[model samples]
Target chain A: MDRPASFLDEALSLDDGDSNNLQPWIGRVVLVEDCVETNGAFVLHHLIKRFLSPNLSSSDSIVIFVAFAQPFSHYDRILLPLGDRQGEGVPSKEAKRDIGDMDWRDLVTGLELAWVGGLGFAELGCNLVVQRENKRLIFFDMLMLECPDDGVEDGIIALYGNIQKAVEAVSSLNKNITIMIDDISLLEVAANGSTKDVLDFMHYCHTLTTQFACTIITVIHEDIYSSADHFTLPLQMEHLADIKIKAEPLVTGLAADVHGQLTILNKGSSDGLGRWKSKIRNFHYRVKENSVEYFYPGGRT
Target chain B: MATNKGRTSSFSRNFSAAPTSSIPGLKYGPNGTIFLSSGVPDLDKILGGGFHLGSLVMIMEDTEAPHHMLLLRNFMSQGLVHNQPILYASPSTNPRAFLGTLPTMLVSKDDRSRNTDAEQKDLRIAWQYKKYLGENKPHIEERDGKVEYCNEFDLRKPIEKHLIMGNRVECISLLDCSSLAGFRNSCSKFLSQLPRYDGNITSAGRIAIQSLCAPQCEYFDKEWDMLSFIRSLKSMVRSSNAVAFLTFPASLVSPSVSKRWQHLADTLLSVKAIPDEDKELANLLTGYQDMLGLLSVHKVARFNTQVPVILDATTYSIKLQKRRSLVLECLNQAPVDGSSGSSYGTSGSCSGSSKTGTLDF
Candidate 1:
């Protein structure tokens, strides 16, 4: 029996043509790194909300690295809680202990796995751990994941290897993952000894995204708080990114009140930035410690 | 004596009472009958209003066997008051070898009154005669005193009496001798003398050309090209702000020739013969059997006039039969007025205007 047709079916029939079969994905692959967005963290957030949502949210994931600068030599002290405030019954952080015990081989293998649980999984299997009532939540996570069997140099190499492996493996799996880097200057400091080392490190970070299908995001602050010339800074990384969104301070009054203004550049082929050029003038963000209140002027919704 | 004079003066005062309002210019100037009255009321109405100074005009008609030049000559008569000169040319008939072929006195007031009883009987005869001919016969009549046969007819005397006594010699009549064989050079020389009389001749000078083609039936050979040559002569007319009227043979040219002629002509008209058949039967047996002869009524192409109008033989039906009946019926049969209802009257004075523009010719 032929099914009765609806108004929608009739309307669709009018536009029925073989040309409609050629569907191209509307989103473009934008290599994001450097600048204040650090990477395509913002664009990735949007992609997840749009394409990966109700349709494929379970398959989508993001990865981040928590590491320290080289040559300091006490990875244990960096990872675990250093102060002895035992009588008060403060817990000796479990995540820092676990990280300090792992070797370079374990780190690389952990990155190869589909997912790596964040911080402490003994108490609760939280994909991400946020310290209760702590304004420096990012700093807390960084402190809880450190190398114990490694020197500062080995620990830096181990972290870098893990990041490269993770990006490459996820890209192979074709997982829609976004990688966020909080800072680039820490590597700048690690390469203070040699120009070749700095160049190598910069080249590695810049080209790492080339091997990965997953998008990478790096966040950097405007004020570096250290002396590094433009060439030594992540200039190579900045140049390779298909997009760069710069955050400038927009301060109104006294009392340390400040907001961020974003200047975005689109460099990707299939990106929707061409359309957004007319709509987005600037964005306002109020940064408090590790988290920020981002105000999109037009309201993203 | 004083009382008698007082009474007479009082009667005169009562008769010539003055107007209440102050009138400017001449006596009875603004609201006078002179302003209200059209020179020829019916003609003025067909012309939208009375003739005005500085109007460029043209009149064209295909000729019957005997020519009719007086209609154009009389039109120029009224035009003379404005100091307009008339230039007349006859390529088909030689006007210089002879005088006016058409009788100007045919429809005069005295002649009209005399024609009244004759008109009634003449119509009855024409009607019965057409019935005898049926449809196939060449509708014919007596072709006497034609331009081709007549040596002289004193036309100027009556024309001067009826049309030109008061009108200035500003009126010029050029009887073009150019169209006849061996007369082209002479006619050209005569036209060259026109510039000298520009002022002595009134602005109402009328020139009549006998035919569009140089030789008889030249139009049937190549219509469009011949019409262009005829149209080229209009430049000479425009140079002096004068009107050029063309006259051609009515029956000889083809339909295309008429169209080409009309394309060049700013105003076009056809003077056709009125068929005698439209009247009655017993008159055919009467003494004056050929009363319907060569007396034509003017068919005008009304252009640039206020009330879109055209007038031909049909305005006066009884008068129409005085000319060749076949030619008039052919003129009536022109496609321009086809499918017209009788409510509009023949000669087609129908109103076809939204705003003012050219007639849809």
Candidate 2:
């Protein structure tokens, strides 16, 4: 990665200069993906640990996705040492039907360990799961299997139905939720849905944002194929996001010996990094925790 | 010269240099000490938290043979350390000596360890790329945290490249002390001409004007009136925020002759020859001590070390002018009797010590 232009670095260092000005949405939600840090999961862990602004309310929540560079099984070992597991007391679907409503703490802890902890929930790698409370809501049940004998139309209907059900469950819980999907492109191809079907899915997402009153964030890889799939997601929805940030490759002095660059992309247009637009005079920027810091030579302040 | 005459005529018409800002590329702080972060802590701190962008920093030593060229060399190292562009003006000393030996000496003594302390977050990526691709031949000292000079070509290009790659610093120094005579000869004509925005001396460049010739010289008399000439030169240096070193021989020029010169300066310090050549370490220690002395005066800057003020037995004599004793007593670290409120002696220390800006070495 090349050093950025001087003006850009200045733009980064130049203080907003307005102290009383309130930036309420600055730390409302953080999107951590695999970029510059370890893998996507490790990036999410770092963001959780280094969330900026110690003043952030506990009520605030982060949305993360472990959507890069490994099979779910591989990440499970890493997550285990960190103390996280998915759905401990709350039964899986089979036991949920057997036992009504498990304790909420169990569900929360379970989700924390799994989505926030376990990092190996979707081992089969086909399903998109949500960890709210202790329960793992399997949003996409069809693990990446070769096309089902029931055919592509049935798969689309099944996929769409599961998504609707998951959205409804998240709304009923009244908890701000982060939905983690593993490579939306894989989901699109797996749905075997026509372009119209995918468009309908995007429209449904818009409806979910309004009806649920919850934040919806997606982590998309910037790979050419995945980016194309991400494009199919509605442009209007992209604008609705409060923030969109990008994580690019970084090279530091100590780590100068390392090889390769890491790139993390956030689908939310309103995240901290995307808000800045170049100006001749001044601009505004909010840095995320663990984000690269650019200091002007004699401390800028 | 004709162009200068045209400019003078134009200036007589319009006072403003241009519609744009006077100090272009200058960034200002609240009280406005120019913050030059060249990514090196030592250089930055040595410069009182970097150069004051719009303030004239005058570096002076007794005129005559020595001049403050060595001090200017130390100053130039700050520019090289950060890899910023330098516009060297060598009219007196050999430019080649500056170009060759100065950088080599700086590079040689540089403990590679210090470079490691730089913001290393980005290097992680570069090294990672090197590891995966097997393209970069990692140097052994890289682990020790040293940034080896990639090559002899303009250091600024690589630094700018690094800055473009996410490292940024603005360092520029001018070695022009030897050119004092030429500049003085040309000043009348140069002043007459409007300073071309596109001229060789851009607004952002650093300037070192060494060997300030004695006022009685034929050159000084023909160029301009003494007082206004001093004021004009000071004004130019101030406007550019250039670190200027004005050299005058202590043996030749009497203090009584130009007490007014000391009046215009913020920090008045003298560089006395150190007796122990080996202990003194030639240019670096002498240069470092004077810089430390100047830094002691500037209230806006904070220093990491308590500077030692020792008179040079070889060059500085208390018996001659008592000037050295006056400065030492004023800035003396320990308490002194009967000298508390004296005009020459200041209660100089780190904090709550004294606000006085005079130091004698």
Candidate 3:
């Protein structure tokens, strides 16, 4: 398996004209603070695209998306282009031919989805696992399995076991993986509103990142807890994370002028001092049809 | 010898002081203290970045007008958008109707711009520039680019689906409580569940008790029961992270009872509809054609002495804008007519004096 080109460089334009330089995002845990007003879905979408970049070996690179808040069908709509409207606006015959030649589903190999909802993914026409000649897309529906009790603890434990098994299976195939947890609050709900349980699971995830050489991206809605006492889970996750990103609606009231603010903090990187330092950057971002564009708040062409 | 003693004392004090954690459920301001958004950016600005966590904010409404309910709706809607759990206790109103009355999400100018070709072109051009600059540019560029300092929540969109699925709304009807003891029990039970119900997020949930004065007066057979209930509620707020919004109908309660409620609250806001006769005076003073009511911020919780007063006893003309934003502007001039002068003059003295005196000279 060959090492993949860094997608962050192309997607976010983080490259400094040095192709050899790799970002510190790998083998790290990142937590995204998001709210309804400021959606973090776009960031996750970009990250998935980055993981599935064509530079990587199709057989040796894998992407696992755990959908807790939404269904697998919703993600299918987001990640895959609409088939009927594929070449609608192309002016040239050549471009239309290119669209037809593109096999969008083959963009990522070993793509696995764990749908942790009451409704099974099979009902949405998603198979338990797709294992074609060389490519694979596995789907795990927790609701299909019987639980010992209706409590959140049992479900969370089951999820932990399944994720661990998946990681081990992918690692055996010698594939580098990236994991995304759609909403951590769902885990809290599963754990019966206990932050302690969520923290315990996060500790396990942190261990997985360090030991297994994987990247984990998770989102937590900050508005869920109003007081500091209830904020223990996110704060703890923030403390454990190597990188923390916050998504918020533009303060000036979402106007035609700006969409939202993306506050990224690379906590692992530091200045000359021995103390742990962080590089913080704020970007005003707008979601477009094909890409998420982030620019300096007031930057004009 | 005196200098050595002073230095030692200072060192000890520093060591004894506990490290401060960022306040939950509030955004950290440029200054040290944390500010919670009141769902209205302008109101948050006026109240020094919304109300502080753990503070009890009392909204006293004029029974005849009842327009202040809009503010309450805004507060709840803001919570819903932010994904903050709301524990609303109302005596008379149906909770579902209350939810329905909420204004739809505010459509931002940017949402409208997506339809324009020019805006799309500009966005494309901006995208190119962003790719070129990356993180190489100075931080000042980003700072200068910030157009607004306050966060706005769109009321038009439905609350996050998960929150709705999770049963985030804990609506308690005090009207159902047959006895004062039963009411107290229900309140205590509801308050007890709040901390546990809050999942991974640190924000303190919002607790709103509407028409506290009006309802309790009827529910509790004795005045003692009403006072005791309030006392218990105050203690609960003080100990927990929840920010409480207690609304009272000023006309229903006696002056003494109102005073007690005011004393218990950390911040006090009063809203009264401007009488038809006073409309001319309001127009003359504010120079605005559509002045709806008068808002007086009687008290602000003095948590930090260093923090300046966000809103004093300034009387502001409340205008319900097309976008559903509550605009509060200080009366630019004093009332000239003697008949209406006394009423506006006293309330307007705090803010209007400077403008009125300057104009006179």
TM-score, one value per model: 0.28, 0.27, 0.42
Candidate 1 DockQ score? 0.00
In angstroms, how far off is B21's CA in candidate 1?
24
Candidate 2 lDDT by residue in tens digits, A1-301: 1122222223322123421122332322323222212223333332322221122233333333323222332222232222111113212342121112423223322333333212233321111122322343232323332222246456555655666666576556554444444433334434332335545654555465556543344443323122334344434333443433333333331122221133222232334676843222221111211122233322223
Q: State how far residue B186 of model 2 sits from its true place (Å).
A: 5.6
How many clashes in candidate 1? 40
lDDT of 1 by residue, B1-361 (tens): 2443334334323322342122211011100110111112223323323322212233334344232343444443333322333444444334433223222333333454346536644644644454344321111111111111111112333333433344322211232322222233333333454543221222123444545453543234544334333433433333332345566654455543443344334344444333457432222212223333222323222221111122222222112233411111211211223432212123333334221133442
Give the lowest summed-lDDT range of ten residues in model 2 chain B: B320-329
Q: After superposition, how far is residue A178 of candidate 1 from its true place, in Å?
A: 60
Candidate 2 per-residue lDDT, tens place, B162-226, comes to 32223122221223323233454443233323233232223333444444444434444322133
User: Rank by TM-score, descending?
Assistant: 3, 1, 2
Cα distance off (Å), candidate 2, residue B96: 5.8
Q: What is candidate 1's lDDT per residue for A210-275, written digit by digit as tens?
A: 555445455443333223454444355556555566654344311122233445555435345554
Native contacts retained, all candidates in order = 0.00, 0.00, 0.00
Worst 10 residues of 2 chain A by lDDT: A281-290
In model 3, the runs with Cα more than 4 Å from the true position are A1-24, A57-59, A81-150, A223-226, A269-278, B1-361
What's the C-alpha lDDT at position B307 in model 1? 14
Q: What is the lDDT of residue A199 in candidate 2?
A: 53
